[model samples]
Target chain A: TQLLEQSPQFLSIQEGENLTVYCNSSSVFSSLQWYRQEPGEGPVLLVTVVTGGEVKKLKRLTFQFGDARKDSSLHITAAQPGDTGLYLCAAPSYNTDKLIFGTGTRLQVFP
Target chain B: SAVISQKPSRDICQRGTSLTIQCQVDSQVTMMFWYRQQPGQSLTLIATANQGSEATYESGFVIDKFPISRPNLTFSTLTVSNMSPEDSSIYLCSVSGTSAYNEQFFGPGTRLTVL
Candidate 1:
């Protein structure tokens, strides 16, 4: 089974602090995606990294895919209380289109 | 992007009972996916529903326990049968208009609390 492991399962940061969440895997993936989920709602897609060593930015959030395509990272600059939520990384199955999600990282930004 | 909605956003059900969650999409999609997420955990794919065909379940899931239906591209349902307390989790429905590596839109999850 291809598993994606995320570091720092829980994070509590003061507003305006910067943080980075890591997602690592041994198996290379064709693509990787990051999502943020709020309570009582489903996850919303943040970014998708398809190429090796690719980086995409969405306002304050920066997402990077490793050179080997086996790992990814999400960085938030000056995180606000609205940034607090569950972050998940997912890799799509090669044979089919099913997504295999990573161990999530929960972030709490205190105002 | 697609707008997906799920019925019964939250439900408290007794053990041994069953609950079926409905998913509706704004646009037609080729595939609809069902996923389960334990408290504070990530998502696990349960099955893939295709129009006019039997749903394909993942390795640890089965059709009997989680029967799925896809009458069309824009709608599907997933039923959790004979629920146990351990079955309490957030169930999500997702759809992708593009390939697997592309973006996917998810519905507001159904939070099932088995008592």
Candidate 2:
């Protein structure tokens, strides 16, 4: 099975703290995407990591893909209350155009 | 990227009732999908709705339980039939992005609560 296992299922951190969420799988993927979802809303795409060992940054969030293409990480620097949400990583299924999501991580940043 | 909207943002329904959620896209899309999300859980693909064709359901989902309609490229609907407490969830509609990567743009989602 192509499973994206995420670490630290739930996290609560103080404002301005740094945190990192990991997504790992036994199967390799050509690319992976990270999404954030708030209550009563669907997930919103955050970033897509394609190349192995590549890193992309968007303001306070940084994304990194593993060299083997089977893992990824999302790091948030100086997290604020607005950063609180459920974080999910997803990749294409083995032989379909559909996406398979990660286990998920719920983050809560307190001021 | 496409901007998507869903109708009846949230609803409370009785058991054995059905709820139809509407999704409208700002542009034409070839691929649209429905997903279900339980509280504090990940998304599960319910089915793939393509215009002018039947919806392809996922392993644990069935058309009779969650019927879908895609009469055109810019709109679709998902109906949850014979709702039970277990059927309460957040239903989301999404379209495949116009990128090489498997990117998808999602709607706000419909929250359903069955009592």
Candidate 3:
């Protein structure tokens, strides 16, 4: 079984601060995805990284896949209150439609 | 991108009773997935619903407890049987895109509370 563990289960930061969340695993994956979910709503896909050592940025947010495809990271710059939510990293199961999600990192940005 | 919607956005039911959640997609999809997210936890896939076929459940889930029906490409339903307090969670419906990336899109989610 492949398990994904995230660092700093809870994060609280002031407005304009920067933060980075990490997702690590021992098993390789064909693809990796990042999602952000708000309270009482389903998660929305932020980005998908399919290549090793690949980095994609969305405005102030940056996502990077590990060189070995066994880990990924999400970095947010100038964090605002609107960026507060539960961030999750997911990987597809081998030859299956299932998605294995990470432990999750809850971010709270206070103004 | 496909738009997905789930019925009964939130429900409070008594233990031992059952509740059925409906998922509808704006466009036809080859596969629809059901997932459960307990309070303060990440999402766990319940089953994968395919058109005209029996749903494939995950390791910890079963067909009897969580029966899924996919009558067509754009719709599916999931029933939670013999509910308990532990069964309270948010149920989400998702579908994979037909693009090369196959990114999954999610519904608004249905929150179920077993009393």
- Candidates ranked, most accurate by lDDT first: 2, 3, 1
lDDT tens per residue, model 1, B1-115: 8999999899999999999999999998998999999867788889989899999988899999999999988999999999999999999999985754756789999999999
Q: Compared with the true structure, what per-residue lDDT tens digits does model 3 show for residues A1-111?
A: 899999889999999999999999999998899999999888899999999999999999999999999999999999999999999999887777667899999999999
The residue-level lDDT of candidate 3 at B9 comes to 99
Candidate 2 Cα misplacement greater than 4 A, ranges: none
The number of the candidate with the highest lDDT is 2
TM-score for predicted model 3 compared with the true structure: 0.97
lDDT, candidate 3, residue A31? 86
Candidate closer to the true structure by DockQ (higher is better), 1 or 3:
1
Candidate-wise lDDT, in order: 0.92, 0.94, 0.93
Model 3 steric clash pairs:
none
lDDT of 2 by residue, B1-115 (tens): 7999999899999999999999999999999999999977899999999999999999999999999999999999999999999988899999999887878989999989999
True contacts kept of each: 0.78, 0.83, 0.64
Task: After superposing candidate 3 on the true structure, give the runs of residues whose Cα lies further than 4 Å from its correct spot.
Answer: none
Tens-digit lDDT track of model 3 for B20-45: 99999999999999999986679899
Fraction of true contacts reproduced, model 3?
0.64
Model 3, residue A33: displacement in angstroms? Answer: 0.6
